[model samples]
Target: MKGLVIGGGVAGLRAALDIANAGFDIYLVERDYSIGGRSAQITKSYPDLTNIKDVLKPLMEEVYNHERITLLTNSEVLGLEGEAGNFKVKIEKKPRYVPDGESCEKCIEVCPVEIPNEFNERLDKRKAIFVPFSYAIPDGCVIDETNCLHFKDGSCSRCKEVCDGINFDQKAETIEIDVGSVVVATGFDPFDPNLRPELAYDKYDGVITSLELERILDEDGPTGGKIIINGKEPKSVVFAHCIGSRDKKVENPYCSRICCMYTAKEAYMLREKLPNAEISACYIDMRAFGKGCEEFYEEVQKKQVLYRRGVAAEVYSNGVNLVLRAEDTLLSEPYESAADMIVLAVGVEPKEGSSELAENLGIKMDEYGFFVEKNMYDPVETEKEGIFLAGCCQGPKDITDSILQGGAAAAKAIGLMGRHSN
Candidate 1:
């Protein structure tokens, strides 16, 4: 009557902790080298501007230190069989190459291979052997075998020579376990703005996605939290909302549900950093539905951040500054706004491999690829008896809703397991 939770984001963490505290053994599986998920990558949470690390780090630590919880990083569920109350699961755990808790970081400084650091949204370069972030759970460096020279042609051993913790011989292992119920908390991926090429996301240095902006706002981030664009503070910054959401052109017509408020939050933070810099946002609509969110939007407006009704139609550089063209739906006038930096308020999408995972777990996915639930009233319960849904894997949602769903799923799992035991 054990429990299993997949995806180690905040939602997954909450599910695991809840089940563990309910006196059930639970296994938490994360596909990445670390377990923090997208929440760890963010600088702050909206409406209240709470430092995300303060919230995430303690939760991660509690999960890692919990006796009834087995934190499995760099792992994925390979298969699930049997029925509710007696499910067999197989997990594939990839080797990190660097031993956990034994990394001296000497390998990083000696490694010659440099690749774009995805953790920082490629704003900086990292050695082939590196950790995902400063506070990554199961803290240690991981070797990117794809880019490591030693794996290519055995051409480099600098990292191995500098650190005794590097283990080139380690291989992936498969673990089999039996659980009463499974919770799918695999999170969402930020909308790739490149899909909308007219915005010139890849064509200009001044353009960046909202997630990238989060990294830049992080003090521990690549630029040391400086709002520097092109090596200098910008005179103006403009945020464009609904890049991949609420648009029929991309087939993602659903509102992302968080972009408007987050954009407002980012604009508010930008005002704090660059008090004299002109700040404005172009949006299709203002949806501040969460608790305190509407008030926060008003606070941002008080900070002198201008909000206009429109969606960016096109973005191009005019040899000096990046120019954004849009139609102000409010005034029914075509306009162009030039800014030193343009942040795209990208939407959320289902995780790329969600469909495959749903099939593997014997659950249904909606047309949009989010895991289908039992009904609107029972949002956390999946169509499958032993399976439950949590977080954005079910659909687009903010952190607060994600956590609530996680707890609901955990309670469902615990009840099922308890009934089976009885």
Candidate 2:
């Protein structure tokens, strides 16, 4: 049996490795130029203290070495046809704009445009021809066709000219493949803060999302681990939870599982960095439902991290510092405070293309946009016989949960392969 997994993230990679090891040929497709997914964007993971790459690298290495797995990057599943066991897939592969002959990242330096790098979440910019991040598993350069001058107009093919004619101008290509099974592990997107007008996302300089905060704390991130606000050092900090989630009236109603833990992690992280600084968490209710979660919350509170149980009605700027006016429902009083920084514990939503792909493939999607499947007997199996779901593509799940689900999906696929061979 042959299988295709539609993501290169932790879950997809894990599933690919598992299926390949079971003697089934596997094809792992990653939309991005690299395969780390959102997991690669993080620093050290909480509770385990494992570096993001440390957990991912070994599996990535296995995927690289595995003869049965075909990994494709900057490629997308344009369309899907046929039934579970015998499926025809059409994929669109974006041109790399660079020849495989002795490639180097020098093409990035020659290009002058600096676009808001998605890997850095606009905290930094990358040249048009550049890798997503430093540790991109392949650590190779990718051409941002949308941003490249050549793609913009044929006149300025600086990347091609500077390459000493080693550059290839092959047009973006599409190809078709056949697989017996498929696994959908496409991940989720963070709820855009711009959707919340009350928070004034674009207007505030100090306010950012948990993801932006991660970049700030990361050694490779924008600030280089300094909690600097608009290039100035400010004292107090506030983390607001449920920005665009857990609300039936406004944004998404579902509780984003990772927010509570990440919020606690941020509080602890901030306190560790600036011991004397004031750090507060404004939340409706703290949910720590993991092995060491409650204890970790205790540790944060014990370290003088203020856990305010309430919702911020509005956030506005008073003068130099951003003012947050929130009622501490626990205390039954209106409280206003100022902070150097504010981090919104944003929620994750399905990736942009998931629903469209589901329809094209005749799969189903839940109202929330995550792929819906026959989860009763085996949670990961999809409505289609050989298709499986894993990672945030199924729903909002943490990294550990994603990894575990990836393994389970692989087992399901392999079990099917085993039965088919018999």
Candidate 3:
């Protein structure tokens, strides 16, 4: 009996690899053009500050090159039927237009259409015919039909003229497969800070989300790893925590679980990059519950990052700098802190369309749209016997916990399939 893994993020990759290594044929389905989900967008991991590329690259390479794993990029599960021991699955694979292993990169220069690069958090523009990143796994250019001129009005064919690999005629197709067990690893999306307009995330040029800052700090990122705001390096930076998490007004009352530590890490990085810049963080409470995370938080404090007990109440421009207004809970005094750049440490939310997917799969989701597990003790198992949950799809978690759950889900899948084979 074969196995199936969905979502193709770090968690999905881990699940597929673990199951495949156990001698099971596994099909890995990823909706995106590339396999490395949101984890690929990150610059570094917290606590250790290890470069994420170093950890993700080798794992992605191993999965792509594995013999027992069939990677289906730009694909989604359409339907599933049958029980734990046997199941039929249908998948829809989208056309990339550009043939695999055949990009000369000349097409990118000739393409007339440009759009916001989502992989870079819209900090830069990319041609309609372009790759998601430098080392995207299925390394080839993908034509975004939504914005491509050729697809819109057939008025432009510059990319096809320059490169023979561009095939506008390629069409999407469907595939059917059989698997004994399924693993859902669909990940989380960062909360939209615009929900809280008081922070002025949409109106200000100086305010950016933490994910955007990750791209800025990346060596291969939009700004080439420079900590620049408004085209100039900021002398002071302020971080506002819990923008979309732990707030009843937004209806997201759960702690995002990673914001505090990540903010601390970012502040530590900022200090390293700009030793003279003043750095401070406005927070409601600090929860360093992870292993070694408390030490890391203390270490960041030693780097001269001022941590104040408060929540950012408002942000307004003073014509010269951005002013953050908040009340220090301990001191019982309201104060305004001025900075050239303000980074909102946004929280994680369930992936959009998660409810639809859960309903289709005959599983249950919480009010917040996270997949509900069989029980608190059996976190990986779903209501359906053969189906399992992994990563942030179950809830907000850090990278380590996501990978851990991925392995746990894989083990459950292996166990069920092993018994069926016997």
Please report the candidate that would top lDDT against the real structure: 3
Which run of 10 residues does model 2 get worst, by summed lDDT?
97-106
Query: Which portions of model 3 miss their true places by more than 4 Å?
Result: none
**lDDT by residue for model 2 over 1-422, one digit each (tens)?**
68999999999999999899888999898898878789888876775557777777777767866999988888899888877667899998876666433247567778888989788788888898887776675556767878877778755666766676335466778989988788889999999988877886788989888998888878778788887878876689999988878976654899888898888887887787888898998999988888888888888889898888897677898887898889899889999889878888988898998878898677889888988868677789987888899999988989889988999999988887677656
User: Which ten residues in a row are the worst by lDDT in model 3?
Assistant: 353-362
Q: Write the per-residue lDDT of candidate 1 for residues 1-422, one digit (tens) a residue.
A: 68999999989999999999999999999998888889998888999999999999999999999999998888989889999999999999888888887668888899998899999999999998897899988998889888999999999999888887788999989999999999999999999898999999999989999999999999999999999899999889999999999987888989999999989989988999999998889998899999999999999999999888988889999999999899989899999998999999999999988987987899998878888899999999987898999999999999999999999999999999999999
- Rank the candidate models, highest lDDT first: 3, 1, 2
Question: Model 1 segments beyond 4 Å from truth?
Answer: none
Predicted structure 1: clash tally = 0
lDDT of each: 0.92, 0.83, 0.93
In order of listing, the candidates' clash counts read: 0, 0, 0
TM per candidate = 0.99, 0.96, 0.99
Pairing residues by index, what is the TM-score of model 1? Answer: 0.99
Instruction: Give the better candidate number (1 or 3) by lDDT.
Output: 3
Task: Residues 1-422, candidate 3: write the lDDT tens digits.
Answer: 89999988989999999999999999999989898899898888999999999999888999999999999998888888888978898899999998887667999999887789999999999999998898798998999999999999999999989888788999989988999999999999999989999999999989999999999999899999999899999999999999999988888999999999999999999899999999999999999899999999999999999999999999999999999999999999999999999999999999987877886678899988999999999999998999999999999999999999999999999999999999
